[model samples]
Target: MNKIFEESNQVALIVNEFGRFDVDSHIMNQTALSVSMLQGCICCDLQDDLVMQLHQLSKQEVQHVVIEATGIANPIELLSACQDPIISNVYEAPLVITIVDSKRLLQNENTEATETLMDDQIRASHRLILNKIDLLNSDEARQEVIQYVSQLAPYSQIDLAIYGEVKESVKHGQATIDKVNLSTSHPHTHYEVLSYDFTHPISHEQLVQFILNMPDSILRMKGYVQFREFPNEIYLLQYSGGLPALESMGDMKLPTTVVLIGEKLDKPALKNKLELLQFG
Candidate 1:
């Protein structure tokens, strides 16, 4: 059984676990208007039911539905929801983005658990993300991680960004919610998550070397970068087994933070390496 709303100009209804079932739909609509849609991170396990709910809601003149699959939750329901009411000209696809942080990877550091998580994600066949590389100090430590992630999933397009900072921008509406279109010049590999962070700052020459010497263990890297000559913020992405790329997002209000997501990530070594950058 489903409750129907009178059809209006509501283009889409983003499904989120904002309130308990006790609240009425009118209250739900009011709450939804006040909240930012991206603030909610969808748990992977409930992706199915969420998708089904989205479908039911779509029947009321809503044209598209967006669902976030943030963790290891299976995306079958999400995938199925996108396939229904598939028009020849317009195909609705559930954009699946898998987000994992370095803390989770570093919990045991170089253990089977970390490897298992990465392995499971590769097997699932979805989008990739290596978050939180800003915790590290130097590029060498980050490279070690880049090398390892590239070997795990060669087909998935990966992006590295400081999750805590950039993610908030999406949630807070500081930046427009635009589909991030990744370039194909660089092959999909672990190397995309390569970056450099310094408490003080470094020169452009040093930054270039860091990019060139990126290791295979580090898979992705992205965050605010500060250089002496190039006193601008940079968003960096390095991929093992492929070409490295860097882009500029002008200036981000967020602090410098990078994230690395991969298999068998060296946690202690990473933390020890990050400690070196503590001195300002």
Candidate 2:
């Protein structure tokens, strides 16, 4: 993202389930990240939104535009949006970047369906950043993943990154992605999604305990809330893959609604757990 803005003020629409706040901390300049015009269930045409956003930017003489889709988004669908004739006329070819978690891919729990989905995603990348390589214990293990990815994306440049921070810019020289039959409707259908808006301050200690005891089925959660102890400040909560991290959003007034994405969620039970943290 930093690399693109340095060259020009062109736009990059970052589409995440929870919005830019999901990645805002990782970006140095929040202004560069634009909220996606649409989200969740790509059954609708994202291409239209891309065209409209591009036309608006082009009026300002913006030369190029790129898209940053969430981890679970279909790469081929996103690429199609960028190649729409209205956008293609103004910007250069789309760059598809796939960021893979090295440690997670080798885990024993991945289902065959997950593996097949990942293969499609990797093939769509012009540049593959094998992120979290630091999580791998040895150079041999790292090399094993590189070789595995090379087989999947023979045309992509494989690069290493730590915590998703690359030492240099990521450039995908590929002009377009080969369209995959993989459905853009793919990511959300199987997951259970639930959200709750807290009207009062939450107990921090209880919230911490809830996070620690969270089941693996809870895939991702993000929101902002005020703690009873802090009173005046709000914190951003990002929970993923059984880990939770809280950072100060610092009295930035926003909704205290938390959204959870998981499979087979027990909504009643989960709500009971969350109620313990909220003001009684």
Candidate 3:
């Protein structure tokens, strides 16, 4: 969800499966005030509570509402909740957009439980956006994936997205939660989650290229970027899948910082690259 709409200022209803602490990682990427974290399964355990939250949000001055569910929560159930009489009266019919990471799906990168749920999501989706098709080696491979995913989501309207640029029903990364406390111990057995603060301004073109040609291993990145082009202003930079977006923040200034989450990341090497962007 953050991968697609992290930069938006709209209200977000982020559903969590555990405690409030589970939300710590995502805090850095979002405006805490605009986000309402519901700590439980929105589809099952806390259906009533989810309804209440939606009702409250609808009454407010919010324009759009984004509901992000846990990976295990099925979209069908969530969509069902959106149809609650109270909610439907105020909110428009929710657009259940499913984002498929074609590379990860084809490579079988997910564990069995996650894999099964993801397939089910594709099978029961409305608008399916297949992201990261550019990661495939050739156009033929990408086409095969489109064909395969289309079969699973026969009723779904499919769109080919490189960054998801063109849009998640099923996502595997922690880009949504990049503000994790990086303990000496690997917080995640396979993923290296960490942050770096830019001590100097980097050229806009250089930073843009860095994101465009970012390593495949770096799953997600978010932070403030101070570029030579916009030296007087601060821009927020967010990267996920292959999409990297830079949005201006007017005169608001914070230390140009970056938080990255991914599997098999070399922290030192990443730090070095950012340094080059800043110092060079």
- Alpha-carbon local distance difference test for all models: 0.42, 0.68, 0.64
lDDT of 2 at 74: 66
State the lDDT of candidate 2 residue by residue for 48-147, as single tens digits. 6656766677676444555555555667776666667776777666677788877877776654555666777887778888887887899889888888
Q: Which TM-score value belongs to model 2? A: 0.78
| Preferred candidate (lDDT higher): 1 or 2 | 2
Better of 1 and 2 by TM-score: 2
Leading candidate by TM-score: 2
Q: Per-residue lDDT tens digits of candidate 1, residues 1-280?
A: 0112233344444443321211112223342311122222233334345545654564555554444332322333344445555332243444555564544454444344435545555433344556676654667655544444444444445555683333321111111112322211211222222223456544556556655654545544434445555566644433322234555545543345444444445666654454344431
Model 3 stretches with alpha carbons more than 4 Å out: 1-33, 167-280
Off by over 4 Å in 1: 1-48, 61-63, 70-72, 80-91, 106-118, 122-126, 165-280
Each prediction's RMSD over C-alphas, in Å, is 15.4, 4.0, 9.9
Task: Tell how far residue 148 is off in model 1, in angstroms.
Answer: 3.6
**lDDT by residue for model 3 (72-101), tens:** 456666666777998888887675667777
How many backbone overlaps does candidate 2 show? Answer: 0
Model 2 accuracy (lDDT, Cα)? 0.68
Ranking of models by TM-score: 2, 3, 1
